[model samples]
Target: MTPNILMTRIDNRLVHGQVGVTWANTLAANLVIVANDDVATDDVQQQLMKMVLPDTIGIRFFTIERTSQIIDKAAPHQKIFIVVKTPQDVLRLLENGVQLEQVNIGNMHYKEGKKQVAPTVSVDDADIEVFKKIKEFNVDLFVQGIPGEKKQDIFNLI
Candidate 1:
């Protein structure tokens, strides 16, 4: 099914209080897809994240590949939240033909060997490279949490 609203938020904390509560509500997301291989494989983590999200939201976890499959199918949807843990996962989805024209980076925090773009965004060389891949698909990638806020394209900064 084609996601109604494809929000490519990049919160490394993935499906936590900020995204689980605030961002999802703001986006009016009816479907929440977590595109992370690590978390998807762990039933415990999956269950944990699921509980944090409001019961009103339909939550699904994908290992990046599954996200592409479902998104490529093309279905009528109102708002779909596709949350990837990293830019590489975004590239993976794009490579598999997700057809997302723009990606909204929510958050990627400080980690070992990663650089900070702003107070909320962080990345490593691998992250930048994958973003470059996404650009090949002509996606408008940016770092912003909410609408009307100033957006900084991490790609431009790199």
Candidate 2:
């Protein structure tokens, strides 16, 4: 009963205007899954995030462990678009046996300690290490802000 995951993206913002609406439309994703511990437990934040989306698009918030279980048991007809907060989260899911075809690096805005790899992507030393581990899995990883934009491989940038 596993759902067909259309796209998996890493965006620190989780569900935002562009990613929640535009990316969902572009990918034709009927379901949006935000897998993060903090947001999943925050009722106010969850309500706010749900308020922004159109009623037609279903959305769910689950912790990483719960998300792995859901992904493993998703319905085949469901087109799931997953959004996680970090590369480390992605790696955690992979380690838990959540299968994904490719991962899109959406946004990871620059912080004091992070290095800018692209216009939108910035990562610290730990982030780079996580990316390296993900690369080892041979998962197709690239950065594309939106559907029409060109995707740049993380390997090449890092």
Candidate 3:
């Protein structure tokens, strides 16, 4: 079955309880696609993520490459959720021609050399550059933790 929504979101924490239980159903997302190369390769982490998803939602694992190929084909008809850990991964999908013009920036926690872009977002210079380049492709990005939170443009803020 196709998903009910198609959303591209950045959540470095990946599929934790808040998003899995709280946000998934709000989007009525029938298929949850976690698009991260690292998570796809780690069987242990993938399993744990699966365990956290509510039974009503279906989840899939894909690297950014695979997701980009399948996204346009499965979009609109599917209530989908695409979660990326970093802006580069999202940019890879965009470079591959996925037409996601906006990213819902969720929780990308702080890390060394990754400056805080928002209360919930952290970005290194490389990622910030990717964000800038991709915006020219007409991608509208916003930093918002939950579904209803006010959207903040990272470019405008930083």
Best by TM-score: 2
Candidate 2 lowest-lDDT run of ten:
69-78
Q: Per-model C-alpha lDDT, please?
A: 0.81, 0.90, 0.81
Root-mean-square deviation of every model? 2.0, 1.1, 2.4
lDDT of 2 by residue, 38-116 (tens): 9989999889889877888999999999999768778887889999999999999888889877999999999899889
Rank by TM-score, highest first.
Answer: 2, 3, 1
- TM-scores of all models? 0.87, 0.96, 0.89
lDDT (tens digit, per residue) of candidate 3 on 3-57: 2336788888889887787778778887789999888889998899999898878
Which regions in candidate 3 have their CA more than 4 angstroms from the true location?
1-5, 75-77
Give the alpha carbon lDDT tens digit for every residue of 1-158 in model 1.
Answer: 44676577777778887788787888888888889999888999899898888989888887888777777553586578888887888888887878777788878778799888777887888888888888889989998866657888877766
Best by lDDT: 2
